[model samples]
Target: MTGSTLVGALVVGLAVGAVGRLVLPGRKAVPVWLTLALGVAAALLGAIVVGLVDRRPGGSPLLPLVVQTGFAAVAVVLAVVAAGRQTSPDPAARRKEEV
Candidate 1:
C-alpha cells in the first residue's frame, strides 16, 4: 500500500476506535493504542468482508465504514473483557482481602 493510503487508514482507524469506545456502555479501561490497533484490524477485516459480499463496482462507501465501526465496537468489548480477565484478582485473594 502507498504511504498515503496507510496514513489514511490510520486516521480512519483512530476515528473508528474512538467511535467504538463511545458506543460501548459503561466505563472501559481500554488503552488508546490497543483501541487504535483493534480499529485498524477491524477496518481491514471489514474491507475484506465487504469485498467478499459485494463484488459490484462503485458500491456505496458507507456500508464499509459502518461495518468497520461495528467491528471496532465488538473489538473494544472483547479487549475490555480480556483485560478484565487478566487483571481480575483471584477468588482466594478476594476472600482473604475481605477477611
Candidate 2:
C-alpha cells in the first residue's frame, strides 16, 4: 500500500479503537499495545466489510472513510462484549458450590 493508504489505515484504526474503548467502559487489563492492535484489527475488518458491500475489490479513494466509521461502530460493539466479559467474573464458582 502507498504511504497515504497506510496513513488512512492508522487513522481508521485509532478512531475505531477510541470508539471501542468508549463503548466498553469498564475495568480492563488492556494495555496501550492491545488497544492499538484491536484498533488495527477493527480497521481491517471494517475495510473488508465495506469493500464487500461496495463491491470494491481492493479499496477505493472514498471507501476508507465510510468503512472506517462503520467499522469503528462495530469495534465498539465487540469491545463492549470483550470488556463486559473481562469485568464480570464467573458468578457460579464451582469450588464454592462443592464446599
Candidate 3:
C-alpha cells in the first residue's frame, strides 16, 4: 500500500473507533489505543476482503480504502457489541425481569 493509502486507512480507522465508542452505551472500559488498534486491524481486513472479492489482485488501494473505511465502521460497532457485552450490563435483561 502506498503511504497515502496507509494514512487514509489510519484516519478512517480512528474515526470508526471514535464513533464506535460513542455508539456504545456505558462507560468506556477499553483504552483508546486498543480501540484504535482494533479499528486499524478491521480496516485492513475489510479492505483486503473487498479486494479479493472484486477479483482485483493486490487491490486498487483507493477503492479498497473506501470499502475498508465503511466496513471498518461496521466492524467497530460489532466489536463494541461483542467486547462490550461483558463489561456493560444488559438492560434488556432487567426489562424482561421487570415484566
Q: Each prediction's TM-score against the native? A: 0.68, 0.57, 0.63
Ranking by TM-score: 1, 3, 2
Query: How many backbone overlaps does candidate 2 show?
Result: 0
Model 2: runs farther than 4 Å from truth?
48-60, 86-99
Which has the higher lDDT value, candidate number 1 or candidate number 3? 3
| Residue 39 of model 2, lDDT score | 75
The local distance difference test score of each candidate is 0.70, 0.65, 0.73
Local accuracy of candidate 2 as per-residue lDDT tens digits, 1-99: 346655776788887676566656666556645676777776776666655677546546787777766766676566556654553345567456556
* Per-residue error (Å), model 1, residue 82: 2.9
Indicate which candidate wins on lDDT.
3
TM-score of model 3 (CA atoms): 0.63
What lDDT is obtained when candidate 2 is compared to the true structure? 0.65
Of 1 and 2, the candidate ahead on TM-score is 1
Q: Encode model 1's per-residue lDDT on 1-99: one tens digit a residue.
A: 335434545666788777767776666677878887998887666666766897767778677667766766677678877765564368988778668
Q: What alpha-carbon RMSD in Å does predicted model 2 have with respect to the real structure?
A: 5.0
What C-alpha lDDT, on a 0 to 100 scale, does residue 38 get in candidate 1? 90
